[model samples]
Target: MTAPSAQTDRFVLDRMPPRDQWPAFRYDLPELRFPDQVNIASRLLDEAVENKGWADRPLLRSPQLTLTYAETRERVDRIAGYLINELKLEPGNRVLLRGGNSIGMALSWLAIVKAGLVAVATMPLLRAAELVQVIDKGQPAAAICDARLLSELELAREKRPGMVRHVVHFGSPDDPQDLGALAARQPPLFRACPTAADDIALLAFTSGTTGMPKAVVHTHRDVLAACECWPRHVLKAAPDDVVTGSPPLAFTFGLGGLLVFPMWAGASVYYPDAPYNPETMVRQMREHGVTTCYTAPTFYRQMAPHAKAIGIPTLRHCVSAGEALPDATRQLWKEATGIEMLDGIGATEMFHIFISSAGAEVKRGAIGKVVPGYQAKVVDDEGREVPRGTIGKLAVIGPTGCRYMEDQRQAKYVHEGWNHPGDAFLQDEEDYFHYQARDDDMIITAGYNVGGPEVEDCLLAHPAVAECGVVGKPDEERGMIIKAVVVLKAGQTGDPAMVKALQDHVKSHIAPYKYPREIEFVTVLPRTETGKLQRFRLRQHTP
Candidate 1:
C-alpha cells in the first residue's frame, strides 16, 4: 500500500495498529485487488452508472421518495461539494454523522468517503454521555445530524466545546440552514479525492456491552473488500433485488447489508419511513415488494407470526446476525415463509460478515462456513489450535480484522496474526462452525458446563415465551445455578403455572439438568440500540 499524501490529515492514521501487528491481508482474489489510490464512493456509485449504461435505474427508495442511480450520484456529489466548499472540511478530517436510517444519512456517508474525510457514524439512541465519549475520542472536526435527533448531540457538544468545530442539521423542512438548503447552493458535480487505499475511511465504535466503546478503524480497501467477500459468494444478489432491513445505518451490519452490498450488486434499497416493528416490517415487505431483508434472530422470531398472517410472497432472502441465531427461530421462519434464513457472524472490526451461508448451503444449526476471503479456527485458552468438536475461542484472519484505535485492548484482541473475537465455538468434522457462547456467557452449575444461549433457545421454543435470557446465579451449594429471565407473549400471564410449563418444556427438549433452576418474568428484556440482548443486565438481577 502507498503512503497517504503529505497534505492528508493523519489523526486516524496515527492511531492505527503498527504495520507488524496488522493482520495478513489477502488480495489474491480477483475482486479483492484494487488500485494504489482508490475512492470507494466513486467506484461503487459514480462508476456504477457509467458501467451499467442505464442511469435511470432506481438506487434508493423510501415511502417519501425514490432516487435513480443518476439522481443519487448527483446528490452525493453536491453534498461532497457542500462539505468541501462551504463547510471548508479538509481531506482526512473526521466528520460525525448522527441519524436514523434515511436517504440523507446514506448520502452524507457516501459524500464523506467521496470527499476523503473519515466518517464517524453514531447510533441515534446514544445519549449525551455516550456521544460525549465518542466526540472526545474521535475529536471530529464537524458533525452533520438530523434535526429531530439534535438535542442529545447538542448536549454533548456543550460538555465538550471546541471538540467539534461545526454542526449542520438536516431532515427539518422548516430550517433554512439545513444541509438540504446548503447543498442546493452548490454545483451538482465534484471531483472524487485521490485517497490512498490504506487511508482510514471510518471509525466504528463497538456496542459497549462490557464497558467503554472502542473505535474500530477500517479503510477504503477494507470496506470494498468486505463487499467483495460475503455478498459475492453467499448473498448473490441480483441487480433488480429490492432490499430493506431494521438495522441502523450506523452499524457495520446495516452499512454493509443495506448500502454497500446493494450498490455493489447494482440493486436498490428501501428505507422505511419510520423505525419498524414486526408488523410494520411485514406490511412494508408486502407493499414495497421487498426481495431481501436483514435483521437479528430475536426480530425474526417476533416477525414469524406477523409474516405468516400477512404472507410476504415477494421476499426471497433473509439474513440474521449481530448475535447467535437460535435453532428454534430459524426453524420458525422457515416454516412460515419457506425461505431459509442465512446466518452469519461479523464484527465492526471486520467491517462486515465474514462467515455466512445462503440458499442451499444453509445448514441446520451452524453459522455457515468462513467467507471466501477469510480463514477461521477454534483455539484453546492458551492460543493453541483445538481439534474439531472441542469448544474453544474463535480466532480469525482475513482481508479485514480488528484494528482498535489507541486502545490497549488492541493487544488482547489480536495476537500473532489471528483476531480473537471472544466467542467460544466448536467446529464439526464437516468444517461447519457452531456457536456455543461468549467466553463470559458460559454457566457452570454443579460442575457441569452449560451454554446460556442453548437454554435461551429452548425457552424460545416454548409456546408462551416471547423472549428470554439465561445466566448463572451465585449459589452456596452448587457453584452456580442456571437462572432464566423471560418475556411472555401478549395476552399470556407470567404466573407460576406458566413458569412451571416453560421449565417442563425445557426439561423435555434438552437435558433435564440444563433446565433453568429458577425463572423470572419481565415485560421486556434489556437490549442495546442495535437489538443485541445485554446478558450482563440479566446477570445483575440474578440472586
Candidate 2:
C-alpha cells in the first residue's frame, strides 16, 4: 500500500498509472525501511550536516569551486527559497533543468526537490525538437537552465509558447534573469518541504532514441531505496572519496552514481568546468585524486591507453554501465589500471544499477547477483522461470520498479508484478546472470540462435579490432545472416583479408555458425551521448 501523499496539486499524482498496473515493491532489506513522510533532499543534504556531522566536509567540488556540506545546504536552501517565494511554484509542480554536469546544475536539481517540486532534468545535447517533446510531456511550469544551453530551450519555448512560464538562467554573470542573482536575493535558509515518501521526486525520461521518450516516475522513497541497495551493498563508497564521471546529470545513471550516491556516503563529487575527453578525464582523475569513477564501457575502453600511460594512483572503484561491458575491454582496463571494472546493467525504469559486483566478488562475464534488496530471475516468453543455464528475458522487482507516467507500455514492462528491462540473459548454476543481447538484438540464422554480444566479445579480443557491433542482416537463403560492423585500430587496414582473418578469429573463439558472416568497416559507431551503442542504427545500414 502506498503511503498517503502530501502534495495538494495532484498534477503528477493524477497522471500516474493505475495502482493495479504498478510493479510489486519489496522492502525486505532492513535498510529499505523509511519513515512514512520522507524528503530525499533533506535526507541527503541537510542530514549530512545535521545527523552525519559532516558540516565542514567538502560535498561538491571542482577545480573552479568547492562547497562544503553546510555551504551546499545553504545554497540549496536559497535556491529552494527562490523557487517557492519568487517563482510561486506549488508542490507537485515540475521544473525542467538543463545544463551540463556542473555544481550549479546539481544545486538547481536538489533545490527543486527540496521545494517539493518534481525535477525534470534533460540531457545537455538535446535539441529544440527533443526539448519540445519533453515540454509537451512533462508540462513543466518553469525551467532553470545553463546560459550556454539556453538557445535550444528558447527555441523549444517558441514552438510551445506559454507552456513554460518562468525561465531562469544560471552560469551567466551579465544576464538579467540569472538564477544566481535571483537566488542571492532570497534568504539563505528555508525549511525543507515535509513531503510524503510516496510523493513524486523526479521524472526521468529514457534517452538515446528519436521517438518520444517514456517518463519514469521516481519518488523520494524510490530514490532513497535505490541508494540503500546499490551503494550500500555493491559500491561501498567512503566519505572522503572524490568521485568523477562523464555521464551528464540528466541520465539516471549519472543521477545515482555522480550525485545521490556521493551524498549517500557523505563523499564529494568533482565536476569538470568543461566537457571531458579521454585525455582530460584521465588528467582530472589523476590530478584531483578521484577515488571512484562512473562512466560507460566505451569511455573506459578509450581511457585505458591513457590511464596506462599516466597513472591514477588514488583510483579504486570504476563503474561501467549505460551499456554492456565487453570482457575484452574489461581485461584491457584491468591490465592498464589494477582496479577491476565494476560492470552492471540498469535502466531508467529501475533508476540505478541493481545488478553489479565489486572488489573480490567480481565475475569474468556475469553481471553479478541480484542487488541485496531485489529479486530477479530469467523467464521465457510466457514469463515462466527458465531453467538454470537457459537463456530468457530478465525480470526484476524490488523497492523500485517500472512506473511510467500514464504510458500504455506499463503493461509491457511490468508482467506478473515483475519489471522486465527487455534484455535477454541466462542464469548459471551458481546464480550469476550472463547477458546475451537485447531481446530485439538477438540474431537467429538458419535455425541457429546466437547472441550478438557473445560474438562481439569474441571479435573484440582480436588485435585489429578497435570497436565493433554485431547484428542480423536480412537474407534470402536464411531468415537472417550475422553481420559485424567494425572500427579498426589505428594503423590497421580493413581490407578483404582483414575481414577473413576476423571471421576466422571469431570462428575459432566461439561457434562457427555464430560468426559474423558479413563484415563492414567504419570509422565510428553511432552511440547515445551516455555511451550506449545504437545497434538498431547499425542494423539499419544494410547492403
Candidate 3:
C-alpha cells in the first residue's frame, strides 16, 4: 500500500450505487447505441443523409467560404470518386495531408474517408523536422498541401520518395497534375467502402510519455466515437448552432471541436487562416453567431481582460482545455459573458476529451467527471487503485485504447491492459477527477514534490501575466526550485516591480512555499504547434 500520508487527502467516493441524476447540463437526444463495425466518413455523411435528412443544410462555414452538407458531401463524393476511379486508391492506404484548415482541406479529409483511405492530417505550423518524422513513420503514398507551406514539402520530398504525388491549390488544372480540377470534374455520389471496427482511420502524433512524439493509431470506432459522444454529451450543439473555435486542425481537440463535432451533428463550422487573435476570433463569433467555443485555458485568460471587446453578449457554451482551467479565468468568463468555461482534460492518444463535466456539474476548480462511456481511476505504481483524493496516475479504459501501429511507444503507454499514459489525476468521492499534472511535470525540491501546473495556475491569476510556464531548474542549495517564465499582456512591460508582484500574487493565492523562486519575464513562451506550452523549451532558458 502507498503511504498513509499520501492517503490523508484522499477523497472517499460512495461505494454503493448513487441516485440516478439525469444530466441537467445536456439537451436530451434520443439515446444512441453505437454499432460494432463502422467507417467514420460513411457514418457522418449517412447520418446527415438520413436522420438529419436536411438538404443543403450548412456543413462548413470558414472565414474563407461556407459550404452546405449537400455541397460538401457532393464534392467529397466526387473527390472520393476521383481518388478511387482515377488515383487508384483503396481503403487503408496512407495519405499525408499537410496544411491548416480550409475548404479544400475539409474536402480532401472527407474525400480520404469517402474513398476509405486513412488520413494523416498534420498541423500547418509543424516544421520539417516533425514532418520528416511523420512521413518516415507512416510512409504515405500521397500528400495534399497548401501552396504557401510547399517549401517544407520540398525538404520532405527529398527524403520521402514514397510521398511523390502532391495536391496543391484548386484551380484550372493545366493538365495531368491538378488533383483539385480532377476532383471538381468528377460526379458526386459514391458508395461507401466497407471497413472493419479495427481499421485505421486516423494516425495522430502526440508527445510521447518518454519525451519523443509518438504516433497513435486510432480506428474508425475510436475517432468517430468522440465525434458522436462529444456533441451528444458535452456541446449539445444542434444543426441550428454555428460552431467555431481556435486550435490547429492537426490537434485532435481542434479536429473534434472545430470540424468533426459540429459536422457530425450537421451544424456549420468556421476556421480562419490567421491566428485566433481575440479581436478577430470574437468578431467572427458574433458575426456568425458561433454558439459553441473550445480553446485553451490560456486563450480564455487572454480574452478575459478584453471580454467585452471580444463580444460575448450572445455566447452560450465556452470550454477550456489544453491546460487546466484556472478558477480566476472561469469566474472572469462568467462575469464577462454570463457563461462558465467548462474544463476538460484529454490527450492525443484518447483522440479527444474522455473526461469532462457537463455545465450543470460545474465545479470551480475540479475538471468534471469521467465521460459516461469511459472508466477512470487513480492508481498506484503497481496498478492497484488508490483511495479518493490521493493523486495518482490516471488510467483509462474504454471503447478506445492505444493501437500504436509499428511504434515502440505503445508499450511505453499501454501497460498491464490499462491505458495509463503518465497523467496524474485526483478523483473525489463525487467521481469528479481533478487533473494534477503530467507525471514528468512534477518538481522535487527539498523533499517536497510540487506539480508544475498547480504553480502555473497560481501565477496566471496575476493581472500582469498573460501566459506562463513553470519548470524545475537546477539549484545546488535546495536541489530544484520552481521557476516561472511569464509572458505579459499586450503593451505591458516586464519591469522589476511586475516580477516581484507576480511572485507575491502567487504566494497569496497558493501555498506560500510553492511561489516561483525566479521570474523571467518575456514577450512569449514556446508552445507546440497546437498551442500547448512546451516546458522542455522553457527549462533550456533557465539560468
Candidate 4:
C-alpha cells in the first residue's frame, strides 16, 4: 500500500520500488497490523507497565478527579475482565457507548477494546432519533449510557426494540452492575483475544453531512495505523508531552488527538468536565502545562478575541481540523499566543489526519503538503488526474486509506486505487493542497462552477454576516440559482435592503455571477458540535 514517487505517476509498494524515491529516499516501513493481530492495548499498556513501571503517574486531570496510569490500567483491566466473564462479550459484539466527558467514559472505551468488543462512541448531545437511527443500523447488543441520558436511549428503544437488550449505567448502579464493582469482581489482569488485521474495532458513524447516516467500520489496523502516521509525517508528538482538547471523545478527531495519540506515545491527557468553555480550557492549559492541543477552527476563532486574558503559556503545538481554519483565525491566534495552529482536513472514514503541514512547513492558509506516504491529486468527475492548480475533486492513495462500511459509497470512494471523498481542492505547484468546498456543495448558477465556500468566504469577509451558508437552488432560467442563508450579528435586522446590500457586497468582492440570488437571514444556522456548518440541513429546510 505504498504511494508512487513524486516524479512518475505509477503506483508501487512492497512488491516494487517507488518510481520516484530518487536519491536514496527509501525507508522500509514495517507492516504491523492493528489491534486484532497486535493487540495495541496489551502492547501499549503492558509494555508501559513493564518498562516504564507505571508508578502513580497522572493520566487524567479534571476539576474533580485525577487518575494515575497504574490506577487507570487497573480499572481498564477490571472492566475488561468483567465484560468478558460476566457479560459474555465475545469478539465482534457491537456495544454503544453514550456518556458525557468523564474519566470513567475514557476507561470504559479502552476496556471494550481490551475485551475485543466493537465500540461505537456516539456524541452525548445526540437525541432519540439519531440514537435509534444508529442503533437500528448497528444493532448493538448492549449500550453503556449515563443515567441522565438513559431517557433518550429508552425512547430510542421504544422506536427500535431488541436493538440493545443490555444497558450499563455510567452515573450510578441501576443494572446490578457498577463499573467499579463489576471490575472489582474480575481478575486484575486480562489478555486480548487473538484477532486479525481486518477485525472491526470501531463503527464510527458520520455526522450525516450529505444525507442519511451510515456506519463506518474501522479495523484494528486503522486505529493503530492512525498513530503510525502521527509521528512519522504529521504532528511529531513526543512521549513526554501532554495532550488536551475540547472535542468529545466520541468524535474521531477527539479520540485520535486527545486519547489515542497520547497513549501511542505513553503520554497523558487532561480531561475536564467544565473545560469546554474557552475560558476554562485556557485555564486548564496553563494549570496543567498542556503541550499538545487539538480542536476545531471555530473554537480557535472564539478564543483568539480573548486570548490575551488567558495567560501562562507553556504550550508547544496545536492542531486544527473538523472545519476550514480561516486565515483570520490562524493569524489572530499566533499574534495572541505566539503559537501557530496547524490546520488539516480529515473525515470520519480516514480516522486520523491525512493532509496537514508539520515540522517547519507552515504555510499560514494553505493546507500543508500531502503526507510523505500518502499520494493526493486533484481529479475530475471521471477520476482522471487534473493539472496542478486546477480545482477538482481531491483524491487520495496511501498505506493507511479508507474502506467504507458499505458497498455503494466504497465503490464511489475507491477509484483507480485512490479514495475520493468528494472534497474539492486545488494542489499548488509545490505539492500543497488547498481545500475548496465540497463537490456536492458547489453552487452552479448561470453556467458557472462557483464553489460555495468561495462565496461563503466572501460573505464571511462582510462584518455584518456573523455566519453564512451558500447553496444552489432550483431556478427557471439559469439551471440553478445561488442562495445564501445568513446569520447576522446580534441586534441586527434582516430587511430587504440589507439583503440587497449583501448581494452587492459579494458582487464587489468577487465575480458578479457569485452574488446570491436569494438571501434569508436567521439568528443561527445549524452546526455540528465540531463547528462544521450543516449545509445539507440548511438546504433541506430553507432551499
Q: Give me the candidate number with maximum TM-score.
A: 2
Runs of candidate 4 with Cα error greater than 4 angstroms are 1-28, 31-36, 52-56, 173-176, 496-509
Which candidate should be chosen as best, given lDDT against the real structure?
2
TM-score, structure 4 vs. true: 0.88
Model 1 ranges with Cα > 4 A deviation = none
lDDT, model 2: 0.91
Note the clash tally of each candidate.
Answer: 0, 0, 4, 1
lDDT of 3 by residue, 1-543 (tens): 111111111111111112121111221223333454566777887668666775588877776677878778888888888877876766767778877776777778878866767788888877787788888777776777766687887788787664656444442246455566667778778877666644666778774333577767666667776765656777677877777777767778887887777777777787765655876777778877778888887777666556665666667879777766767677777777778777888888778887887678877668888776677789988888999989889888765666555555566566566687677888999988887777877788887878888887777677777778888998999989999888887888888888788888888888887988888888778877666787877877776
lDDT scores in order: 0.89, 0.91, 0.72, 0.74
lDDT of 2 by residue, 1-543 (tens): 256776777888889888888999999988999998999999999899899899999989888799999999999999999999999999999999999899999999999999899999999999999999999999999999999998999999999999999999899867666888888889988898889999999999997643458999999999999999989999888898999998889999999999999999999999987756898899989999999999988889899999999999999999999888999999999999988999898999999988888888888999888889999999999999999999899999999999999899999999979999999999999888899999888888999888888988998999999899999999999999999999999999999999999999998988889988899999999988788888888877875
Kindly provide the TM-score of model 1 when superposed on the true structure, using C-alpha atoms: 0.98
TM-score of each model, in listed order: 0.98, 0.98, 0.89, 0.88
List candidate 3 stretches off by more than 4 Å: 1-33, 166-178, 207-211, 490-496
lDDT of 1 by residue, 1-543 (tens): 675552278898888878667766766689888888888898889888888764888999989899988899999998899999988989889999999999999999999999999999999999999999999889999999999999999999999988999999889766789898888888988889988888878999998667678999999989999989999998988888999998889999999999988998899999998756899989998899999999998888889989999999999999999988999999999999999999999988888887888888878879989999999999988889999999889999888888989888888888887888888889999888888888888898998888898999989988888899998999999989999999998999988898789889989999999999899999999988888988888888875
Q: After superposition, how far is residue 513 of candidate 2 from its true place, in Å?
A: 1.0
Q: Candidate 4's residue-wise lDDT over 451-521, tens digit each? A: 78778777876777767888888787998888899989777789998898899998998889889989988
Clashing pairs for model 2 are: none
